[model samples]
Target: MTATAVQRFYRYHAYVYDFTRWTILRGRGQAVEQLKLRPDAQVLEVGCGTGLNFSQLLARLDPRRGWLTGLDFSEDMLARARRRVAAHGWSNVSLVCADAARMDLGRRFDGILFAYSLTMIPDWLAALERARTHLEPGGRMVVLDFGRFERWGPLGALARGWLRLNHVETRRPYVETMGSLFDRVEVHGRLGGYWFTAVGSNT
Candidate 1:
């Protein structure tokens, strides 16, 4: 999907994302655990729709010193995230309405995540490239997203088709792209290739 269609898709999905995504969007906790963030780490989540992953992320940081930034292209999604932050009284958290592929926040982060967000990007390679620039040296970037379902046999095709209808491209070489951009890359697939996590360490 193009950038405009992606924005439009989330404009409506933003309302129900928190209520409905638990069934399909998996591995958030495991992926966050893989990040291994420090108490004073600075965290950034690209394509952080509705801030669903913020609580898990914020829990890992030092409330007094650590900071979290949730960035998304959709204003509607960021609005929900803003409300979530306010309701939870999380002062260290901030939200940015910006394109993931072209964002320049003027500072690098200790941890960067793309939880089920990378595949939805049209220029996913550029998004990875941008995230790399935003990563601090010795930092880690973890990406958790839908995989190609290669282990599911015939059902894999059906699952990929369904995700494509929703604007997520499951067939892309996400792990390979990370290997090209990062110093060290580790990949893992879960639920028979239904989803995956790629951990890239910056050297």
Candidate 2:
């Protein structure tokens, strides 16, 4: 989908995004837990829609010392993220509006996360490459997203079609790509392989 289309798609969905996504957007908390963030770690969350992962990220990283940057292409999504940051009075969190595939923050980070975002990015490989460049040596990159269903049945077919309608392409080889880019890669399939979590290390 085009950038305009993506923005338009989230314009109104931003309001109900967190409420509805919590049920189906699984593995997010597990991904955050696997990050093993340092107290003063510098973390970047690409495609951080409405800052849904911010609270978990903050709980892991020390608020007074660590820094969390949330980046998204949709203005409407970021608006809610801004409100979340303000309402929480989180001084360490920052939000950026930019394309995940092409943004230079001018510094490397200790941890990078992509939460159910790669499927929506047409140039996901480019985004992953860029993320690798922005990771400090020995840094970790985490990915949690939809994957192929383990079962082949009507329900699986319907699920796949519904995801495609939402512009999510779950057929992409996310684990393979991460393995090729990082020194060490670990992956876990969950919900009967309907979702997956991948962790890649720059070491």
User: Which number leads on TM-score?
Assistant: 1
RMSD of each candidate relative to the true structure: 0.7, 1.0
User: lDDT tens string, model 1, 23-71?
Assistant: 8899999999988999899999999989999999999999999999999
Per-residue lDDT of 8-28 in model 2, one digit per residue for the tens? 889988989989998899888
Tell me how far candidate 1 lies from the true structure as C-alpha RMSD in angstroms. Answer: 0.7
Positional deviation of 191 in candidate 2, in angstroms?
1.6
TM-score of each: 0.98, 0.97
Write down the worst ten-residue block by lDDT for model 1. 10-19
lDDT of 2: 0.90
| Residue-level error in angstroms, candidate 1, position 154 | 1.1
